[model samples]
Target: MTDVIEREIKIKLDIDPSQLVRNLEKEGFEYLGEEEQEDVYLNGTVKDFRDTDEALRIRVVNDKVELTYKSPKMGKDSKSREEITVNLDNKESMIKILEKLGYKSSYVLRKRRISFRKGNFTVCVDNVEGLGNFIEIEGIDVKESDLVSFFQDFKGKFHLNGEPITKSYLELMVNKLDNSNPN
Candidate 1:
């Protein structure tokens, strides 16, 4: 069995989620889900960032609160996903709590994520639920697991599942809810 760990860290981004989506497409990435994840996603993409041999995930809006569990990938056909997740509600209010807690909202496009070992954690990436893109490596790190290691190590990372992942669920919902850009 492989040693694994579970942990998550979310931050607010400064980029226009839609613009980030466009940049991802220009780099050969495409949306992977428009249905699953949680029904919040509007434009999700399976994108790899610049200057990398493999894809680096860059989602628009992830859930404000999330939960995760990790263990091992087991095998190629491992059905369990080896993950456990819990998503909190009232994101608007939670953001206020997060702000008070001192965790700065992030601005780096591909720099936001919750990492696990051996592929297991899942939740809203960019506010998209049921289905969102993901990346994972195939190894174990326990003595000192780095949160960023998930992106740094495996390099075997890939999109989660489904079709046409939204660019930004917020904007998507906004357009649907109002039919006009908020900004």
Candidate 2:
């Protein structure tokens, strides 16, 4: 298992994903390739993950599967949290184990992500299955202010003028689902 502090910022993209990629390339960000990821979010038996602001999920990318635990968001300006991840060899067995332990699957999020890198930061342009496009700038073991500043600089460089979205994709999906099927 590996643990790290995830500090990042997300911005809703107003332009197309290709345009964003081109813009990033022009700004000296090297394209890092694309991948399709499926994330299955699980809820704890005793505590609701949404209420606790924590996350437990299994992410499947290509042939690899990883189980991840994310702590609640910390800083007000950014989504800074402690993330622990463990790679598993058998996805089905791990899922069954978690289910037997009372962790129930809550939501599934799928997206196509194109990654880019410039310096110490990695930028991802994501096209979610249901949700729209978004740009996420992530830095590991970095100060919250520095990350935020980098996000601001990136936004200005790309002529983007949108408020940063701190909510996770799972939260956004849940909200969309709830709104669509109102009780």
Instruction: Give RMSD to native, each candidate.
Output: 16.0, 0.9
The 0-to-1 C-alpha lDDT of every candidate, in the order given, reads 0.32, 0.91
Off by over 4 Å in 1: 1-9, 39-125, 128-183
Judged by lDDT against the true structure, how good is candidate 2? 0.91
Tens digits of per-residue lDDT for model 2, 7-123: 888988898879889888887899899999999999978888889999999999999999999999998888889999999998789889999998998888999999999877899
**Model 2 lDDT-worst window of ten:** 8-17
Q: Which 10 successive residues of model 1 have the least lDDT summed?
A: 48-57
Predicted structure 1, TM vs. truth: 0.25
Identify the runs in model 2 with alpha carbons over 4 angstroms from their true place. Answer: none
Best candidate, lDDT-wise?
2
**How many Å off is the CA of 164 in candidate 2?**
0.4
Local error of candidate 2 at residue 171 (angstroms): 0.9
